[model samples]
Target: MKPRTLVIGDIHGGLKALKQVLARAEVTAQDTLIFLGDYVDGWGESAQVIQFLIELEQKQTCIFIKGNHDLWCEDWLKEHILDKTWLFHGGQSTLKSYESLNDAEHALHLNFFERMRLYYVDEQNRLFVHAGFTSMHGPAQEFHQSNFKWDRTLWEMALTMHKHITKDSKLYPKRLLLFKEIFIGHTPTLNYDVTIPMNGCNVWNVDTGAAFTGSLTIMDIDTKEFWQSDTLVSLYPNEKGRNR
Candidate 1:
């Protein structure tokens, strides 16, 4: 049997939830795991989460995409400057997680973050992006850095586009037809009023809002089968989440 390509949504430092989602998904050595980023911030345990991922890489294939939060983290690690925006959006918890690490350990974590990708395209033309592509030229065109980690217009377009239009209703946008499937995570599924993964046009949103009150999601790229953890609030019963 072929190993499944499992694409996971934003983790947001929810280590317990991340563990449960992986366990429920029955992840194994043969499976390929693609993390959608925002690995730090929100809940506590950001350091431990990165450590766990580093260890997991020794056993299975894993791909880490860079999200907006992850980019902030990289900036902090590389420049040694605190970003006010990152701080306002759960950066404190991430900083707390790294406070105890020694120089070597800190370097290891930084290296991992530095190696993350902006976007990944598979052989079949499927695109996996942290947020979404922003090229007016479409998916085949290289995207700007902001588009890969911070673009919300793609999701907005996907959500609001008309399913059917008159023949003369202006040229249908080419963005929706650029890829066989585009998987993303920055936009939480709950925003769409659904807790589970929601498919719009050819885009699939897997971020079930692990940073807030939502659950963590893990889905099979081909099968579309998914498993999710309990509500994030339940994962850290004793503490309030970052944005909660």
Candidate 2:
């Protein structure tokens, strides 16, 4: 019975911030880490973030779910979406993530990313979705394959279907809500606090929009304890050299 349920919010490529937060969180071998998606885009170190995640998965019980950003990445790679948008949204960082890898290694990562699940569930707790789903489907995990995978509409609909309670807040709070606490990202917080009020329901917005700021946050699901880091990092060699 591990006491800590470390759930990381949307990273958005800020590897240095994420690293500092992880260190402050003091992850241990006994601790299980659940990653909410959107690990790429909008930061300087998308490649490092992905590679770190891959390594962590090998060493620990890391459960991850997909975000819309991830889907878009796949779509772009598959020619379903424009690559320029991906590049513009820090996709270059992701591309650079494979700079040291050979062709085979890059392809392996591509395959791994492609096979990522949209959401995950346990008998006691569900995990690691970049955004949540709402549907007539009985359980949260019971969403249809296509509906669950790339359908933001399905997730939004499920929130309404749950009939969760909500209210208008200072930050555009007219949205609907949900019953279950779906760990999510995508929508950013105004102050970059790593918390967003999407529908004011059980859903928790964890992206914190680090691409615009330096704070990357993680919440302990079991205890609702939150942690963050604001370390700065530069991506380009020139930037690094100048800072040094």
Clashing pairs in 2: 47-97, 133-155, 134-158, 135-158, 194-208
Return the TM-score for each candidate structure: 0.94, 0.72
Candidates in order have lDDT scores of 0.87, 0.60
Tens digits of per-residue lDDT for model 1, 136-206: 67654754678888888888887776465422346655776677888999998877678999887778899
Clashes of 2: 5
Model 2 over residues 61-163: C-alpha lDDT tens digits?
8887777667666675555456776666666666655567776765655665786777776556543456544454423544454444344543354345445
Top lDDT hit: 1
Q: Model 2 TM-score?
A: 0.72
Instruction: Return the lDDT, model 2, position 129.
Output: 59
Give the poorly placed runs of model 1, Cα more than 4 Å off. Answer: 139-143, 165-170
Candidate 2 residues lying further than 4 Å off, grouped into runs, are: 1-3, 75-82, 125-128, 138-180, 191-199, 231-244
